[model samples]
Target: MDPAVRMVFKNMTTDLAEQYPALVEPAKLILKKCNGLPLAIVTIGGFLADQPTKTAAEWRKLNEHISVELDMNPKFEVIKTVLMKSYDGLPYYLKSCFLYMSIFPEDRNVSRRRLAYRWIAEGYARDKATADRYFMELVERSMILPTQQSVCSIQGFDSCQLHDLIRDISIAESMEENLVFRLEEGCSSNTHGAVRHLAISSNWEGDERELESTVELSRIRSLTVFGKWKPFYISDKMRFLRVLDLEGTEGLRNHHLEHIGELLHLRFLSLRGCHEIFYLPDSVGNLRQLETLDIKGTGIAMLPRTTIKLSKLCYLHAGSGSGDNEKTYFSKCEDICEMQRDLCVGCCSLDLSDLDGFGRCEAFHLVCCLMYPNIIRGIEDSGVKVPRGTRKLKALRTLRYVHLAWGIAIIKEIKGLTGLQKLGVVGINKKNGPGFCSAISSLSHLESLSVRSGDGLNGCLDGMYTAPENLQSLKLSGSLEKLPEWIKGLQNLVKLRLELSKLSGNLETMQVLGKLQNLSILGLWDDGFKIDVLRFQTGLFRRLMVLDLFYSRMEIKLVEFEEESMPNLELLTLSLGDTEIAFSGLELLQSIKEVRLSVHSYLFGTPKSSKNGGNEKMGKTLYEMMKREEERNKPMQDKVRQELQAQLDRNKNRPVLKVQ
Candidate 1:
């Protein structure tokens, strides 16, 4: 009846404990052998959960096995024995996948997508979906621990990490089987035999001379660098390398990849955070077997035209935001500066009245271009261009953040890539709106889509009356008269972000969004709606967990949450002007946990009042009114605090309230 023992039984056998009360004592006796170690208890519990029968005799047999293992081994060895027994129970397919986790460094959060792609590239699974299933199975077995979940609920866990104890066992097993070779600072370079997978970590003190002399590079199928990059590591000898993951590796230059094209068998190449590299060598076109090429967060703008030759490419991720050089350019934007310093808002609202023929979204881009032409040039030209004859890459599953400025011809080329599941394009305009829409509708497997409009354009997205039903995440930044009717049909949608859409206070649009059954995250940024009051009606947003409402120019006088609305909302973030706004119905959020509020006077370098004498006088009066409103609303603010505190005191999940 110890708490830990009871917890193990409760977690592993909820109904079994109640059904077979006679087995409780024997289960406790087995759990007692864990000696208060949570990991051992969980591992043993997971093993027992998989048993075909739940009986007193079976429980006694397990306890006897644990007693025998403990008696035969030392205290430290007992824990390892228990873990090894669990590992021995795993199916053959999962064993290799589990051992592969040893390639990652300690405390690293391994991305789910990255791991799945690597598993597929290693020939462990037929495809990404199959690899993902194997990942989940390991998680269920308590072998891998989940660290984060995806914004889209359907995508499941986003990242995972192995416990130190589990990782130690994996490292031992991998080296014993000659499946992986790990190189660290001051470690011996003697890899017993053929090195199939090489993981170089820490500050590697040895140079290419020591590596080349001790290790055989010819047979290295995968090379992952967690520390410094040695140029000679990618020589022509590594012909059989299938995965070259130099993600975040230091000292990597453009010239270092001169021989990358020779790795004809390379299926996965990720230079995700290598900031020094500007362009890939033309020789990269030789990677005919490449499937995943990730260069997001790099200085690379346009890829080599030879990229079009990668007919087998499945995932091409490039252009996340302003690269290293463009970071200085973004500093000039006052809105971005303010957001970064205090409010931390994702999107910035701009005043486009002075800029002719430009939507708010487009005006922001134009302003950046005008301020520092040279600096902004790289940021503006960040997206990868869809080359001509790109239709040959029919195997593509993901093509994200591509520049649509390539014109309708390039936009039309995307229509031929029918296998694309996730697509993101920037610089949409009225001229190619129909073509873009036509191309999108043809992608039957598209699950995620993001479209940003071009400068001086409106209604670019109005032509889309239909969309892929399987869409789970959609982000749109433009000017729309109303919410697309097609969005209401996307029953599978899980995360939706709308920026600078200027919905014109359409209450029907709110109703349409509230009806989405699977929506968990909703962001309405930079005047997504021009309404005076934002309200959540009763019985709506039932599954919503995170809600972000950031407004710059639009003054929302009140945000009312009707009873029974957003019952599952846990985190709420709001940005408001220096105006008195009532936040009602805090007690109704049964699952509320964190509330972040920011109050500011002006934003986006646009003052609410002009410096002229007459305007200054008006501003003084407005300031006085706001002061009086704040004084009058003191009691309401206290009431808000009291309700939040009450929720924290009564509910097991404590709520956090932050105001700036």
Candidate 2:
């Protein structure tokens, strides 16, 4: 049992026993059946306690409802009954927020602020006044328990979690009530299917027969299908649909999407992982009101010819993936890459071909295919001329994964795109000059800047480009052999990540990063060798909250440091490299509420006392102590410890150390 759960149930049980004496015994039995499940205890227990009638008939009806409504999932029937009873007791306004959670995926953790935001988005609550009040009301009633311990200072709610079982139950009830839909099983419904809003899984292959049944989908307004589905034809009957989500269904062949142009009213069409869907029929230009089109995984080998006509299209994820199935279209930028509207080219090599027809684009991601020469040829063949002044890209704000191979050419051409706010790219070429770096540093609104590492090329980042002043988050990975001095200039950086390194993190770089006042999450992985100086400099990270250091080669003992340095730190991870590292003070990391220690170090000395030894009882007691430490979150820790101590006392007269 989780310690948090034990505390919650113990208090709730005691309160119910005093207030609702009649159902207290039965409630205890039900809570025991829950096995300390938090969601069940809070939601169901709260509902049951508020019931106006505890008569035999009402209780029987509740149990019957559980047996029937929760028949498919018997494992959590008790929990479902608890929630059903509680839901019946809820006021009309609170019920709305609780039911709205079904909109999120099952077992997903939701923050109170985000949930409130979504409620506002859905117009469920008129304003923050009603939404916030309802959220607090739920917390006060103990219907939605807070997942975190309130530290008096933390304002508002940070995060909340529903028991996985309860989440599933909520989703089931919501799906039945038509609030949401999750197509886990095979799609058996025809166009006349009763489902209002649909979220289908394309991860599992559907029968071709499913398409035949989709002919009457005219009434369906919104549809979300997983991107992994093999290219399948969309029925012409889906004319009434407004939103079509094909996220992660990369297998949509050109012919499979022929009917998309017919849905003229379609406002949002997401092809997030449609990497293989290389061609969009010119018919797509007919969607005059199409607001968003996401083709995140569409790795265009070259530009397409017909995209130039999409006047109202605001978003597109037309980028390639790193796989054999990767697909790219060949066309000019004016004709393909840069339509008459905004295009979101995710992970696709940017080919500034056919720039003549270019229009103002809101955003573009150049993180794909950093290999320059091949992409350049594709751009040239498209006949899109790159003028000295590319005015159309001026409004762009975010750029990511731009390959450094074409860094010089692109920077020179797209210098007019001065509105960038977030940028992620690699700098490996000697030709990457101060002007290119300056061009990047000019974007004042830039909040997140990530640099690609130069692994095989050491000393490549000696004095890299100076970062923009507004940069708040910086992530470095994949062969960043050394830290450059220019990083210190980005004083506003709040979150930093250094992953997959080769003997990096020297003292100079650490000292510069340690001074950043707003730094929050810091993740470092030094697989090659240990640099212990950074570990002791915990005080330098004054405002750091979360720290993760993995697979280090350091020789220091992890248990020596006290937690007083990280006053605001909440989570800490220490991966030990040597057996001499003691974990005695691990429980004393004052500020740290949660700690994860990996025991990779080898255990030294002969067996303390194997089961084959004379002091068998002593060996068992020690084994129990080790097990308790391994399962640290056990709710009955005190009782378990006392039991082990008694066993140890009984074995005190035996040999303390006996050879196997």
Candidate 3:
């Protein structure tokens, strides 16, 4: 027998085979029909793992089915036959969820949360939790594959993708059952009945008129467009559409959605990544059935007052969430640079003397001037302002990136949303900190909370005495004098990120953080601490797997790691200061797999050195100071790399060391 076949049988049916020894021979016969293909073997093994009975009759019956199917079909159809058998064996509850995978583009890494929301919108599951269970069920059965794991350990996976062969079979089965209509280039739109779900691929060549003429648009329960926006597709004809997902669609402007309110049946509307849209029509209030509204990467700064009418709104994601702030800023700037490059390319081909060409060039420059500043401002201050009556959204479970610039009253209103499981708010200041804390204390069910201060200054989060005990993920982007006392009580916290929090060598803060038994991911960025010598004591941070420490202003002399500290640490990211810093106890991290060292150039301003007196380098040019700093830090950077390499060489894992 093939070794792979034997392994699969042992892993899938170890208990069943041991208990029903008489059926072992028939199971082996079934494995032989797999032709040594891993996919076929795994699929067949998964099917058997979920069997209701493990008797000899059941084993022999399955063997006969596989033999008859493989003999009747060609060699190429063997895998398909095996996959179909697994699909056929799936419980009725999971069949529709599996078929729904066909709606996503081939090889697309679908967001787990987005997919769950869509499943709920389609009435496949009762809630997000239930939808997630359905997804994991398919994953366990080898029908779907996970591409990314969730940051919070309790949540199984972050994103997933379908195997190519699995996707092909899913597409075939979905079309055969008339469960979905995938519109692509050169494909006919004629269906046996009304199209319930329409997925327009990026390569779709049919025009809106062609689609309307061939299919009944009114019956489309869901519409998902992949690439360029087709204006005619959003007409009032799609009155029954429950899901309108135009995420990442190009050319989708505000005018294109002027009539969107006519689709009162829209339960899930995602305009995420449609940057061209600047405002939403007030008519959106007519969508009383809307439950999920995702406009994360759009240009809409404020939601219309009409949105308060969406009593069923459960998920509302507006501005950016926690991520690499510098990276996101540079990416937005890169978009502007790309536009400038395009303008330059156009100018090169234009005739200088032609008045029309000059006029076009002037107009393009005008657009650049008008759009550039807004994009930069949006990056610095990103959030959607909710109007009054927000407290009426009692059903809201997720509300992120709400701009407190709207008013302190918004915080008071948010407190009424006791059902919120995740909440993120930006634009916090000293004046509203108390109110914000008050509102947070009222939310007993919040599992994830993110707060960002309006300005990069300390003392904004000084009075927070209470927080939700159920929080699993917490992110704060303000300067705090010290870590909050209440945070030490959060035993369930798994992920924590602190940015611009000028905690200058507060020993109590480290002690408080080290005590979090469930904390696994920690990020300290932009002078989170300004200590000279940092040390991780033994038995501290036992559950941590990822640690990120990035500093631009502080000069640390050494970072000591004690034995038995962070035994599970898998990845470490540390910034090298201008002063020489020794990294002692590097071999203590038994599970370390990757270490990233970053050396940042002081290009913005010269660092204040007490030894050299403050502002002593004011006469020098910024570039000169930056060059001097870079030259001084090079030796220290090399020494750190060498030390890391030497220690990693002796380690069994042979951890990767990166210096940048």
TM-score of each: 0.72, 0.56, 0.74
Give the distance in Å from residue 258's predicted Cα in candidate 1 to where it truly belongs: 1.7
Per lDDT, what order, best first?
3, 1, 2
Task: For residues 367-422, write the lDDT of model 2, one tens digit per residue.
Answer: 22233434533322211222233324443444443444333554564344566565
Best by the TM-score measure = 3
Every candidate's CA RMSD: 13.4, 13.8, 12.3
Alpha carbon lDDT of each predicted model:
0.74, 0.52, 0.76
| lDDT tens digits, residue span 11-45, model 3 | 65576566877877877776655544587676666
Write the number of the candidate with greater TM-score, choosing between 1 and 3.
3
The parts of candidate 3 lying over 4 Å away from their true place are 1-37, 40-73, 150-156, 322-381, 504-506, 527-531, 550-557, 571-582, 591-645, 652-660
Ten-residue region with minimum lDDT total, candidate 1: 323-332
Candidate 1 lDDT, 22-81, residue by residue in tens: 877887676555544576676666666667977888878766666354345354465787
Candidate 1: stretches off by over 4 Å: 1-73, 151-153, 321-382, 454-457, 479-481, 502-506, 517-520, 527-531, 542-555, 567-582, 590-643, 646-660
